[model samples]
Target: MLSYALLVHAAPYSEQGALSALRFAQAAVAQGHRVSSVFFYRDGVHNASTLMAPPQDEVHLAEGWRALAQEHGTELLVCIAASLRRGLMNAEEGVRHGREAHNLEPPFVLTGLGQLVDAMQANDRVITFAP
Candidate 1:
């Protein structure tokens, strides 16, 4: 079984790239392949926002990704620089910026590009989903 790493660079609502990546990851796992990690970069950092509240009838993209991570033990990583630029912060960042709340929490970690490089080096295959 091949180990896969996914890189998503699109926002959930803005495009289908993230959704497609999720499906591919699920299918890969079901087929007995291992998914090492999912790296969210660029606008894709929006997927890690805890403030996302979609209509009940619509699918919650963030929740979907979170569930996948929970069930499959897949690492969910959002680019720190990209997330900061988009105002998506963890508790530490919120405290540093004098904010009362943070949008990124557990199951989604903020990391550097070095993590992406590491994923590429560790996984057997790296698939990128872009908008």
Candidate 2:
């Protein structure tokens, strides 16, 4: 099984990057390949926000990503700088920023850029899906 790392750099609904990454990860798992991690950067940090409420007719890409990670046990790491700038903070970050609460969910970690570097080191393929 090939170990893959998916890098997403687009916002949740504005483009197909998140969906494509999700589908690719799912297909990889179905084909017996291992998805090492999903690294969210730039506007992709929105994918980890629990506060997202897309229109009823629109696809909830954030939830879709969350489900994929939960089902496949994939590590979802959002760039800490990106997420903080976008106000998509985790519990600890929220406290540090003097916010009331955080919106990030489980399996989606607010991490440093080092995580992506680590993924690149460990994964055989590091594919980037940008807007």
Candidate 3:
């Protein structure tokens, strides 16, 4: 099976980049390919925000991402620096920063760009979704 690594560089609701990446990943898995990892960078780190609450009429893009990650065993990695700048922090990070809340939770892990490089090295293909 072919292996893929995706880089998402747009906000979930601001553009279709994140959504497109999800669809691509779903299609890849449906076609028997493997999605090794999804690295959220720049504004794309907004996808990891836990405070997002879309209206019932609109699709919850984050749920779709979580579903894809769970069903496909794909890793969801967000850039630590980007996430922090965007206020998406895990528990440890929140405490370290003396923040009252942490928005990023399970299924999403904070990581460095080195993980992106690792993904590039490990996967057969790397796709970047830009705004």
Candidate 4:
């Protein structure tokens, strides 16, 4: 089976990048290809924010990505720098920055660019979905 690394680099609702990456990941799993990891960078870290509550009619892109990660046991990594810059911090980060609590949820880990480079090195394909 082919292994893939899905790199998402856009905000959740602004454009189709996040949604497109999710759809592509689902299709890849359906077809039996392994999605080794999903790396959220730049504005893509917004997908892991637990505070997002889109309107009823609009699709909840963040929830969808979270669900996919849980369902497939996929490694979902949010770049620490990108995440913090955008106010998407995990428990440790939130504490360090003096925030009351963290909003980033499980299955979404805070990591560095090294993970991205490693994923690209190991995967059969490194697919990027940008703004």
Instruction: Return the clash pairs for model 2, or none.
Output: none
Model 1 steric clash total: 0
On a 0 to 100 scale, what is the lDDT of residue 124 in model 1? 98
In order, candidate lDDTs are: 0.93, 0.88, 0.91, 0.91
- Candidate 4 or 2, higher lDDT: 4
Q: How close is candidate 4 to the true structure, as a TM-score?
A: 0.95
Top candidate, metric lDDT:
1
- Per-residue alpha-carbon lDDT of model 3 for 1-131, expressed as tens digits? 99999999989888988788888988999999999899999999998888889898987877878887888889999999998887789999999999998999879999999999999999999999989
Pull out the clashing pairs in model 3.
none
lDDT tens digits by residue: candidate 1, 8-64: 998988898988998898899999998889999999999999999989997888998
The window of 10 residues in a row where model 2 has the poorest summed lDDT is 62-71
Q: Residue-wise lDDT of candidate 4 within 32-117, one digit each (tens)? A: 99898999999999999898899999889878887778888789999999998888998988889999989897889999999999
Give per-residue lDDT, candidate 2, residue 4: 93
User: Model 2, 44: alpha-carbon shift in Å?
Assistant: 0.5
Candidate 3 residue runs with Cα over 4 Å from true position? none
Error of 3 at 46 (Å): 0.5
Summarize candidate 2's per-residue lDDT along 1-131 as a digit string, tens digits.
89999999988878988888887888999999988799999999988888889889987887777777878778999999998888898888888889998999677999999999999999999999998
